[model samples]
Target: MRNSYRIALAGNPNTGKSTLFNALTGLRQHTGNWAGKTIALAEGTVEHKGKTFQLIDLPGTYSLFSNSIDEEVARNYIVFEKPDVTLVVLDATSLERNFNLALQVLEMTTNVIVCINLIDIAEKQGIKINERILTKRLGVPVIKLSARNKIGFPLLLDTIDRLVTGAIECQPIPTVYQDHIEEEIKKMEPRVSAIIGDRLSARWVSLRLLDGDEKLLQEITKRLGEGRE
Candidate 1:
């Protein structure tokens, strides 16, 4: 049997996410509708250092809040399917706006790597990114990449390998809310944890519940029902 691990690629649209996917997968990619959903999801395989990494390219969304079907699909996969590693790609020139999704993923999973893509364009635009500072702030690995030129490709793959092999560890920083919201989350977290049973971050789920995410609540109910059956 071949050693294989699943990696999810997530990012906002127009962040060159598909470009990176194409470059990495290189003729080993396919697209199909996500299970029970009309949204299309891309899948491919990459071989690095004797391990097969199955890359699932999730739909591009500005947030995993599930405001749309695309967002719902992406969020469900990350929260439920639980890939070995999630590559959160971002535009190097627009880090602030891109960070919304990144932070959300960090809340949902610790197996994350933030890739600042389009470094070449950012350099031309006189934008500088300090990956070290970003890594420190986000509490996860950060990589500067120019996928079009294959810059940082080797390091990215090596990092993935190290992470999957337990040579490197990721400790993602979860978002902290205000006092009232934090209190509410504190009250609800244990209940959510009891229902999910370590399947997801209870605090994050509690936050979503407080935000009035009825869809997520329904998903949790549906999943639990399915489990019982």
Candidate 2:
């Protein structure tokens, strides 16, 4: 486990997720598609904190539902591969919407860090964000970034260090949905917990399944079955 850490970068479209990946990996990145899917996967390795870290740049998508190849690819990697850490990038200039994806991913695993990018643009637009408040609310490290300018890259690396080394902790800001949804989650949560164990968040898995995220459900079922006798 100490030899290498795999980190997945997930986020919505045009959120500067790829730009950040490029910054982190430089010319080291290589691309390939999912085994049977058309969706492309970009991966690179970098030495950090005396350990080799494998960074996967997952396709940007609005949600985890299997509505498109990109979403399915991203969802499958996180749910099945179970990477060591997932850094969900959010566009600082449009966080109100981009953040929905961050919250969604947090539900999947506690190993999530919210990378808020484009802060330079947000400030120029007169938008002010309290990083401490956001971090507190998300229960995850929130690092500000301007990928183009290479600002906050060190902070991002530090946050990743905390996550991969198990120094930082993430607790999903609890969500309470309508009665029917809550009831459904109640039914699925225990079953998922009994299957996947606690590394994968049961509530998040339930929500993904409820929303017809086949990529996740299929991956979970496959992994769980393998663990059985």
Candidate 3:
């Protein structure tokens, strides 16, 4: 039986993502640079119900479009590595802006759980988040907690356990684009799916190609070439 699962933690800058990572992994975590890249990543592990989860703290970025090296590393890790679960941390006080990254993550993978951190501060500021509405709208589980106060950690851990054990199912909502853009995606999706071959999200890849993401294209070509060798 598989007792270990890979989980990726991603979010925008200053969303308390690193704090949550440290809280969950404690002294078990380590920081290291990704292969051949100056950018560093933090990794750690947590045990829940006799199962182990290896968590990788990805560099914070606003979007996964790969506009910079940080975005590129985070994007490639999620799209290529295909972690067992992706915990997208969002700031409850600034959820409107944070949704940009969360939505992109849903578009890329269905194995996702949205975490609204810093809820206590948001409440003090008179900001409220209806996680139920978010879950219904996004078609994935939504959780709220204060990573700093260590509140909601139990539910968060249980949620992760259910997701990893297949006790919960995620049906990520698809991102709707303008009609013309959707038409272009439709034209390219099949071909992109063929090329990617279950390794990544074809629709997401097609969108990047349309946007002239040469880096992603180069990486895909390199990977495909390597596969053929």
Candidate 4:
């Protein structure tokens, strides 16, 4: 039997996300609209080192807060589908903006890899990023690459292989909110964990609740209720 893994590629628009997807999957990609939504979904398959990986390229979005249909589609797949690894590709020139989505994904799941794309542009613009510092800060493996040039793909694939095979472990540190929000999260986490168990991060669920994300709350409630009965 062939070993297989599922990966989700997420990022903001114009981060070379589609470029990386095309590079990795070549002719093995398929596209379709998301279920009941106008946003498009692309999925492809790639085999590396004798392992088959199914990569789902989510629609580009600024964040996973579901402010838009694209955001909702991306967030739903990462949270509900729970792919083996979620790769957040970021534009190196705009790390501040792109980092927001990366942090949000970290809160949802620990199995994450931060891909810093557009390094060549950053270099031309005289912008420097310390991958070591980023990896240390995020508590996840950080890879710097020019996806357009297909640089660092081997390392990316190796990292994915290790993560999927449990050869490397990831334990992302959750982002700390303000004091009041932290207190609320502490109070709500246990209850959220009781409902969702380990399938989703309790802290993230609590954060969503505090933010009054009615749609996500409804979906979680419905899924938990159905699971119970």
Q: What is the RMSD of candidate 1?
A: 1.2
lDDT of each: 0.93, 0.83, 0.93, 0.91
After superposing candidate 1 on the true structure, give the runs of residues whose Cα lies further than 4 Å from its correct spot: none
Backbone clashes in each candidate structure, one number apiece?
Answer: 0, 0, 0, 0
Candidate 4, 1-229: lDDT as tens digits = 4499999999999999999999999999999988888888899999999999999999898889958878888998999888999999999999999998999999988899999999999999999999988888889999999988999899999999999888999889778878988999999999989878898988898898889999998888777787889
* Clash pairs, model 2 backbone: none
Output the TM-score of candidate 4: 0.96
lDDT of 1: 0.93
List where candidate 3 sits over 4 angstroms from the true fold: none
TM-score of each: 0.97, 0.90, 0.97, 0.96
Q: Write the per-residue lDDT of candidate 3 for residues 48-143, one digit (tens) a residue.
A: 999999999999999998689999999989988889999999999999999999999998898899999999999999997889999999999999
Give per-residue CA lDDT, model 2, range 1-229, as digits (tens): 5768899999999999999888888988899877887878799987777887799999999987778878877877886688988989889989999977777677666778788899999999999989899878878788888988999988888777877777867776776799999999999999989877875778888887788876666766777788785
Better of 1 and 2 by TM-score: 1
Lowest summed lDDT across 10 adjacent residues in model 1 is found at 171-180
